[model samples]
Target chain A: MTATVSYVPAPDAAPRSRMLGAQTRMELRLLLRNGEQVGLTLVVPLLLEVFLNLPLLSSLGGSRRIDFVVPSVLALAVMSSAFTGLAIGTGFERKYGVLKRLGATALPRSVLLLGKTLAVLLLEVLQVGLVCTLGLALGWHPHGNPIWTALLIVLGTLAFGGLGLLIAGTLRAEVTLAAANLIWLVLLFAGGIAIALDSYPAPFADVARYLPSAALSDGLHHVLQNGGGLPLGAALTLLVWSAVALPAATRWFSWE
Target chain B: MPPQATHAILAPSRPDEAASGPALEISGLIKSYAGRRVVDGLTLTLARGEIVALLGPNGAGKTTTIEISEGFRRPDAGTVRVLGLDPLRDAAALKPQIGVMLQDGVGAYTGAKARELLDLFAAYAAHPHDTAELLELVGLSDVAGTQVKRLSGGQRQRLSLALALVGRPALVFLDEPTAGMDPQARRGTWGLISQLRADGVSVVLTTHLLDEAEQLADTIVVINHGRVVATGSPAELVRAGAEGQIRFRAPAGLRLTSLSDALHAGASASEEAPGRYLITGERSPQLLASVAAWCAAQGVFAEDLAVERRTLEDVFLEMTGAELSA
Candidate 1:
């Protein structure tokens, strides 16, 4: 070995935007590759949409049942990917020390979170496309502007994504796994996604309206089903949830 | 590996920030967990291009110290500077310059293939080593398509090492870099680390292997009870206070005051056990000649006479009061 010491120069960090794009692309690929996530994010929502539209399961009792089923199933898909899927995957990542390892890298925490958000949004786009195509095949007729539905989906994603991170970051992996699944089931049955809010008693219906899932379902229902303008109350409910949950998650989230 | 290949793989992208200052500096660092002080007033410094190994028993605060240096944990007191900038406050700037190889190889996404994981980490830097070349360098090319979780323990470790070097970092903090590796792989890693130094990259590694520290480190810091018990180069440490010894198998009771008188001052001879004699003194040709002459006069041949020098392990055990491997 030569005694001559040649100093290697220090490397600069890649552009932050490029790093973010790479991270988002990697995350989306992993999400798509995971069989269980694919089942939850894509297959489960499609099956539910099909089963709910069946003649025996149709409680609305009309040719317009697909209208109600399509919007509500879209809301459910958002929750599945943004809340349930993100929570379980992130919890395990934390348990396995992946987040702690990334914490030491040049990648900033904001970039990590943004990359995950972008990935979730991208996955939601695919889910929405699948659900809408399945709805169209089932003879569904939609109404109102699509822009309002996009707004509702975006806000609903942020609200649910924040809560998912909050649960995943604060709880143990096993606990997060159970809690996230349990919450998904409860919201699916009672939060006005599969079942209309009016089907419940008046008091329970009023309270469920504030739940993020119910708010998203109600907003999407009004816009697509009733051909209404922006549902101010439902949108505000989701906005408030995001304002509270995102900051809280940011404050309390632990990398390890 | 050829020097040219090593140079191409590890060459830095720009000149260092401060060419003359130490690569890392820590002073009066204090950290506690659950009211128990783990790092108590610890201090250390590494000159540019020097490799320093932190040697300690389990729970001796080695990991905590390194984590503090890496900006993973905030010290309760004192400060740490990497590349002349605070580790925590300047982390955004410092992270790009320093590489960290964690103890458990926990950074990569387990579901991603080995090559994909390396490529992802490489994308974080402007000038990263080629992913294919890095996999080849770490002897992981055969398993490049294997998922991270499917790789063996040593393979995962090599992958972790490749991640740390992908960014062309100026300094690297490695925690037990060769743990769980076979002897041949361990030697290969040692050579790579030496090459890192020849490229003027500074390193701070923690190891339980005493011989590893002695062989690779420019300075060895022995920590016990969250404090530095001893710090010096390997040779300086072994030669500090411990003297060499000469042992032989001979008649037990044959050693009388005659041997003591025959030898020079500050030297002593004793029969530690039956048929075994021990002598402690500064070892030299004159000392050996005197002992041989004394044995000739006493009509006793020194059978199996062996000269021994104090090793770094002996120095470590003497200071830390704990087994090196513990």
Candidate 2:
């Protein structure tokens, strides 16, 4: 308000790092403000944690139901934040020309990708804390290194987030809208987030373990339910999936 | 609010800061989709502080040419320079130096507040325009906190203009910048653009409105079939097609042969109706005076005498051909 003038910057006046930081901050605000996104990313996971832990659904996870249901719910949280929420938001952004607008700015394309990824990761943390608070109240106990569980969370995020971008970037917004939700539902039971891989038949369990969702669910289960040593299988599967999907997303993403 | 005490950025602080150079230069630009050329061998240039209006029928490739210059699309064949650098090759370097306003409400973040979005864009520039004042300048202050999705079409157009100017660009590209604005807002926007030129920001805008181009542009480029049909000032282009017209009412049976003899070269007069006459010739006060003199000598009164000059619309329709685009 002091000394009024139109305040456009000369070329090279602002540093690139600040632009990326601002983008990340704006992306975070948008993600948090959307009511549907908030419900899916945080509320759904907490509801699922409480429901699956109820004595009525006890048979789904066996004697130590709290430990089992909590991990699965955490995995679902990761899936929701990284996959469904991010995909729908980005798909609509592309459809609405938000991406094209950003593409025209001085902000780098790589920075835009990093900025959105960071925002999702940041939201996933809030999701984890809220769900864990509810999990603890429901008598859920974590047995392993919280560190190992954290690794699975990050890896799970990349794998799912990568695929989200791939779909949102390549497909039509309506198609991406339908496909993201469908994929999330399909993976919830079959890929081991809700149905533990070990509960399935032997060959099917083997195949599920190869899924990023399964690897995340099982990895978090191993680390949090069994005192953690190392989640090697989960890490490797997630690493491979992340390596492929992230690059493919980068290759296929369109601005408009 | 009407910005009763608003200090505008319309006056760029460093009006003399811009050096003498072509803000944009394009030659032999070509673009095609599915083997159909959208922009074919198009050439155009914009100099510092100048406004070039690219007028065309739909599908004339004006948008395509602008996109290529903005680095949004790659030209299949051509050379383009923005501030003397390849727009495509040096996009990162060129981006901060140019501002672009896309057509049809393309770039708004519907969920974010209008002010918040502008602030975020301001962060991208080393010296962005004052965020709040920009909203005020564009008449968006009342809706600063409102979500983009809730904005009216005219408000969105104003916001788009604000976003385009936030980067303090040396050159700006606007695709139908004032399309949805009300008459007052359009006048305000034209005032802003006029000041943008005074601040030494070169501009290239595409529009279907010939009057807008005629009033605001220093040079008007008429394009058709993916190529430049004619390029000149609005006055020059209008004059190129036909001379001004003169109309009056007199006796129905006045012999035009003597009138033709009294007129200058290439001038013709015809009776459009019972008592109405039209004359097409070189437009001058003398021509109108001569018509009056002839009327007086013939002992007839010239009623409803009016002189009308050719307008940009005439030139546009003449060059582009009058046909409805699908």
- Judging by lDDT against the true structure, name the best candidate: 1
Off by over 4 Å in 1: A1-7, A58-63, B1-17, B253-258
Q: Distance from true position, residue B260, model 2, in Å?
A: 2.1
Q: Kindly give the stretch of ten consecutive residues in candidate 1 chain B with the minimal lDDT sum.
A: B6-15
Fnat per candidate, as a fraction, reads: 0.59, 0.53
lDDT (Cα atoms) of all candidates against the true structure: 0.89, 0.85
Chain B TM-score, one value per candidate, order as shown: 0.92, 0.87
Candidate 1 residue-wise lDDT, A123-180, digit = tens:
9999999999999999888898999999999999999999999999999999999999
- Once superposed on the true structure, which residue ranges of model 2 sit more than 4 Å away at CA? A1-9, B1-20, B250-255, B272-276, B293-301, B323-326
> Cα deviation of A174 in candidate 2 (Å)?
0.6
Docking class of 2: acceptable
